[model samples]
Target: MKKLLIVSLGIIVFILLSLPWVLILVGRNKLHDYDIPQREQLIPSSDSKKKVLALFPHPDDEVTVAGTLMRLKEDGHEVVLVCLTRGEKGKSSGIQDEQELARLRTSEMEESARLIGVDQLIISDYPDSGIEDLGMDSLKKVVLNLILEKQPDILISYDSNVGLYGHPDHRLTGKAIEKVFLKEKGKEGFSPDRLFQVTLCKKQVEVALKLSSGFQRNYPENPEMGLPQPDFSVRTQPYFDRILQVMQAHQTQQNVLKDLMPFHDKVPAWIYSRIFDREYFREVK
Candidate 1:
């Protein structure tokens, strides 16, 4: 009986150690299982040459809407990326010094912006993971000034209310943008015609939660997590190659990329293309 019990314990330990590899295998297979034909619906048309501004807290945040940016550029609209920080405070191996990491990340971000067809890139001085420490009034002012200067027709950012598992920087940057939008939208002076908050579809969130606890453990206990009802979605599968290229640009964030997107080299190109298959956004204005 004791021998059987020891064998069972050994089996459990082996399974626990192998669980991550198994999950990645399952995730890759599941990517191919999605019905691509059913997801090929056309995105809404926008006027030619419209200006767009995306505000986010970190370098890689732009990946969330990479395909949308590609489409906007293809449509002849001017797209700009404004990141709140260089993501210098992100997780890093002991090899690279902090300064070196920041420089590498900044370069990666610029390359990503270029790949995404961003005509302009504005990186602010706010510290990574420390946007909350920046006063609310200051945060709003910084974003407001950019909106006024750019005079964009569209603004996009993370969903402030939920903030992709409640990262403080993500939450603060988004809330700042939302506050600016609410206060200035249709005001006598300057404002973007519309504000769109990017969100994870329920399925994506559920998958992420199941596949990795990194994000799930950090999600705040907020009812707002359930709130971002998407008003529209962009079928980004057509621009899949570009999205993957953009993600690859941020090589310093390989771990993050792996976690945020269940992609691997072994997966077929068609299946991996589903990485940025759909991007959901809710119109706040």
Candidate 2:
């Protein structure tokens, strides 16, 4: 009877503590990608001569590059956001109607664009769920048209291994984009002659979170699933009010941001500003 009691206690303990650790371990590995090495800190210099184009899988991807976009725009570099989809599945609260949700997501994205002073917002007809491998011909055509229209000097998009972080759509989009970027690179008439990826420094994620107003709160399983800091970053503190304002515009993603959390929200604004860090890719010319 004593031995039986001990076994029961051990099983109970594993069921509770062991389960959480398993979740903490495998859950994190499955939740976000940790492949990219985040080491360098992005430092901005004088005004950049390059006009940058950021390609986002969804509306919120823009936030990942928000600081860089804000700085680039201020420094005389034109910035445009190309949202590949309307982000229809982002119904976190689960109260919104599906059709209404997609429409609302679009509106939210629009509001975000306005806050960023972004001149253009492109929403592709690609399905909300799968953008990476869908009609390559159609995607190429869409991207090609944007190249002609925006004439960006640089192109930015998700890392090639989008799925490592647990989102299949992200990876597929990466694949599709890789094809499109390769085809358009240096091809006459395609604007934005270069390409870059949105990366974060593993070491700087804490910094990224601080600068980002604590975005990406839930996926802490592998906080490293988050991208490393980009090699080049901009200080948008001068325009942080605008940054915070735009951040609030993403109402759907509110729960995802950590700053909105209880304890973090209480911190002073100056401190938060010091912590913010954002980065992205620059395609090889």
Q: How accurate is candidate 2 locally (lDDT)?
A: 0.60
Candidate 2, residue 113: how far the Cα is off, in Å: 0.7
Root-mean-square deviation of each candidate, in angstroms? Answer: 8.9, 12.0
- The model with the greatest lDDT is 1
lDDT of 1 by residue, 1-285 (tens): 999999999999999888766765565454433432322222345444678898998989998889888888877778889988888887643434767777888999999998988999998767887888888898999999998898988888987777776677888788888998887888866758788888765566667777756577776556455537666667787888888889889888877777777645456556556454677777786
Count clashing pairs, candidate 2: 26
Error of 2 at 278 (Å): 4.1
- Candidate 2 wrongly placed segments (more than 4 Å): 1-50, 132-138, 204-230, 259-264, 278-285
lDDT for position 98 in model 1: 66
User: Which runs of model 1 end up more than 4 angstroms from their true locations?
Assistant: 1-48, 93-96, 221-224, 274-276
Output the worst ten-in-a-row residue range by lDDT, candidate 1. 33-42
Clashes, model 1: 0
